[model samples]
Target: MAARRRRDNVLVAVLAVLAVLGGGRTILGWFSTPPPGPSDDTTTKIVGRSQLAESFARDFVVTYLSASANQQDKIAEYVSSGQQVTLPSTGRQVSDPAVVFAEREVSNPQLEVWSVTISAKVGKGAGTAVGTSSSAAASTASSSGTTTSASNASATAGPGRQYYRVAVSVAAGRVRALSLPAAVDAPGRGSDLALANQNSCSPDTPFGQVVSGFLTAYLTGSGDLSRYTVPNSGMVAPAPAPFVSVETATVSTDTTGCGTGGGTARVLATVNPKATDGASPTLAYPLTMIFSAGQWQVQRIDPLPPLRNPLTVVVGDATQGPQVQSTPSSVATTSPSSAVQVPPAKQN
Candidate 1:
């Protein structure tokens, strides 16, 4: 028994020593550990959006896509010498050219890449098109064992949005293309999906009235959200609200949040918010509500919408992309285009 007690004492003493060391390191910063979270740039020590890389990448894509054979000289301003970007023979015009994704190279911090998507309204231009080389995506086989290539299939199919990815080197504060831009596919779209909120709620009902009234107060600050929500939620309306008016376009409830929801329910609503500049943008909200004091009361807005998929981690994020999640404890986010595809340089 005495031998066992000695062993136990030794083990406890070792653990106590470790605990003290750990506490000192955490409280006094003794071991010089790195920060618990990301740096001020919200990323790593080597990679960052430091050089206005997004702007340069966006401009490079726009100039490359506007490939008029006669105006190939315009590309020289973006792409480095000795490198050539394939120009579409039929001219392409791009508009609303926005950067959808930006990426940084950890191995090479001086290099940044971005993917810019242009829902360009392509129009036919009579000018000649220039391409360094030609390759066919779709080929036809003739009866004589001969093959033919149709490189202009996409060009003839019609006009629509196109996506491009380009990498830029922000070396010594000079932003230039790291390589030729390559055609990238648009984000994957989901089809035939059902959601809990179908905008079917009538504003005349008590549920609808409460949801409509709460949103109006939240956006316009004309009323108080505390009046519509359960007490102690501390939901505050924005001071000097951004919208002039809020209209409930559609609303619905999930199975648990549907019906009279005498005790508790969830309400999903779509609102048309008119900004001060007369710009009306549609917004969606996923919220929870409670029934108390013989009346319906608003609850905290859920951080995420309810998903109805069989094998899903975040179906709503994939489908109801633009929906906003608001709360003191939660934040809203959207999908980012942060990938790039760098094709090989042409031989000719």
Candidate 2:
């Protein structure tokens, strides 16, 4: 009887230990957190799509506007079958078709579309019709008299500024469709004044003196500009003139659009260039002045009514290949005698 009771007690103790372990596991399972599942970030995906769209739009515009027969052939590769490529028959030449902005109009896993708007200078020139300019005689002989007159009319049309819109579509990492280019209105000019920041400089201080001195040097192309401009300022000295005449000089404490101040000021100066032959046209200078090395210096000279898009590509006739022209830093106004204040330099 004693041996049997000891065996029973050992069995009961083993059962209790197993029950305790099982219960502990069950409790832990109820409170423990599961590992996180995979997540997809949509922001990164959207940004990537935008970049792709912009690149496609830029390339399409450049290629479509190309006068080269080789470039025209490349356009078909970017679009699907049966898509119409309606190019100007008169061979409209465009310069500086820069994309000011672009955005995605439609997005999907299988297909994406983008709308790109650009600013360009559009012009028409002689001998831009299909085929070589030397073929003018051949065209005249093959076509009717009216056709020749039409060609002449096209040749006489001058160039004008215009904005354009292009639509691009992508699928499976390839351009699948493209829309015909269309003309659109340009965006309105934005405010020229920059927001007030720590870099602001007063117009009457050394900054002003620096601006005046720099303008004097710039107009006459002869002055001690070292005391008034930073080294490597890229300020081009005007060619020597018989005399420099300043009709107006307006100084502003507002750096608004010029740039961040190390020491900078904006000066709107109306200058009259008097040459030995006669009185030259009056020009305006929207000057940005910077202070450096214990003196205020000229930093940058902005074109009046700043260019909307600086990266403009000039497309020449068939004989001439496409050429890229940098936006002019200084612009001459059409009005010879206008008291227009220089707009402030914008923040980059």
Candidate 3:
């Protein structure tokens, strides 16, 4: 009996030791492993590469499209000599061609090659005669898949808009080469144009009042946005500080083709940037609104489109204020209107 009890005690001791060791391992594992969380490095390299590609595309397009005396040299700075093609000498100059959108895809990671699609506006310069000449040149380039001289490259590019794809190689944050521009077929208004809708709400209605109040709150950052906008509507909490003020606003309502329950509206506002220094510039803000919860709220704020007037403004700069997001399903269906038509470029 004494031997058996001693053996039992030894067995109990071994079992307890095993349990303690297992528990210790679990504790160590708990300390060793980290809980999952958002990672900043996720797609960081890809995004950086995309930005570089876009920058290269912008520089290449602007330099190639501009009919300047130093156009070839400017383009050569961004691409290889072999890639640099001589543009037509038609003196068809495009002043201030701004990039509207850019899409980049990595084609070869080892070679740092990217395929980029760019949409840009060619501001009016010299007149329709230069426009005609440039359009002709663009048509020629499109057909041959190679940059040709002014004589063979005579075709209309468009009213003042162009979309093209180019292959780019970037290394060490610099553009090494760019392929010849391949035109992307952009026939219709594309996704930039908003579908037309019938007007249902008037400026004197309560919906209009709510819209005005919402705009005031959004621009001034004075009121709670949560009270006016739906949750997850892409509006940042504690609305960003306003860099501009509304000088005048004309509200128009659109009821047709806005989905089932609600409709859309627009407020054409004349705004002035509030600069700390002297002389701030004035701009136009086409605010898209929607009827929600029996009241009007901001759906989207279209970027300042290209304007033909002397007081026209371009809001594409980094210093520009926050852009209003697209409308949520609870609000409407139609996207924002096409950017305002840009006026002719100021001559030198």
Candidate 4:
């Protein structure tokens, strides 16, 4: 009996030791692992629209303006150089990537939430133009396939519409392509122009209203965005152009690879000014939107016509009757395009 009681006490001591060790491990894991709940902040970095816009502008200038071979070779960094870009003189022909970058102008910066309707047709057209590239060609056939090469290349590219949303991200003050959200398919609009006039064209007929709702939800963290989708199915529609907007325009969507990774939507109608009395002008082009987190968000607004900077020109003749000599004008010929390096907005 004595021996048995001694053995029982030893067993109890071993079990208690095991429990303490196990509990220590569990506590360590609790401390090391991330909590199983929503994070305080999901954005990698929170920044204001002005800072984001200015950063985008600076990157646009540097990528397009830098002179070294580094700048020249860097063309592939933003866009595939082999792809087609409009020449200044020719309409839409494949040209040097540098030339297209050269035309990039980052002025009259405006960032806001507004509704935009993307035409499926225009999306298809841009995709078609981009679909026929050598890189896409290389997808199929060993580097040496001959007769079936081009067609095979197109096939290897996968369907152009599969990638509905073009993901854009700004890192270290430079804009680069990023991963897109999951849902990217827009129910086919089927080449209809008149449909644009009706709210059924999308959740909001005015389109800007839809965009406003999106911005309200995304920027201000208010409002629900379930209806902004293409089919109103509660799923977000993919948009091709996430970063750039064209003027009031018609777009074709039948071609492949227009907005490649992001689905493409074309501009089929013109937008009149939304703010009639504001100092800022109205939208001249259609908008492109991306579906994210169960709602469509405006990623690109249409490019407006260039606004002329206010000038103060004085008409004076140096050769007038009064004895006068020509003096250099006080107005500087080259002023800074924009103030360099506005600090990023301070975070709380």
Q: What is the C-alpha lDDT of each candidate?
A: 0.60, 0.53, 0.52, 0.33
Q: For model 2, what is the alpha-carbon lDDT of residue 347?
A: 41
Q: How many residue pairs clash per model?
A: 4, 11, 14, 26
**Candidate 3, 1-348: lDDT as tens digits:** 999999999999999999999999999998895877646783687678777887777667766766565567676676667864767764344442333344454445455777776545455542342223344334434543333344433453433446677777866666754567777754343123232222333334444445555565566665565455554568663335644343324333344322224566554544444533433445455667666655456666667432222232223321111433332223332332221111222244
- RMSD (Cα, Å) for all candidates, in order, is 18.7, 17.2, 16.8, 27.9
Q: Which ten residues in a row have the lowest lDDT in candidate 1?
A: 131-140
lDDT ranking, best first: 1, 2, 3, 4
- The model with the greatest lDDT is 1
**How do the residues 1-348 of candidate 2 rate in per-residue lDDT, one tens digit apiece?**
999999999999999999999999999989989766534676776667767766777666656665454345676766654665555544456554456567778877888888887554445542243322223222333332322333553454444335568887867666644766677765554333221121223334444445555666666655555545567776667565445553334343344423233455555555556655667656666666555554455667766522223223333321111333433333322221212122233244
Q: After superposition, which runs of candidate 4 have C-alpha atoms over 4 Å from their true positions?
A: 1-22, 27-77, 80-164, 167-170, 178-348
Among these predicted structures, which one has the highest TM-score? Answer: 1
Two-way TM-score contest, 1 vs 3, winner: 1
Question: Residue by residue across 1-348, what tens digits does model 4's lDDT show?
Answer: 999999999999999999999999999988796777634452323333334533443333333333234343444565446644332221221211110111222322331321111111112233333334443333222222422345644664333312122233444445543221122343332221121211112222333344444433333233343444343444332332122222222221221222222343432233322222432222233455553543333445446321112312223422222333332333211222222111122243
Question: Candidates 2 and 3: which is better by lDDT?
Answer: 2
Candidate 1: give the clashing pairs: 89-129, 101-337, 199-251, 257-266
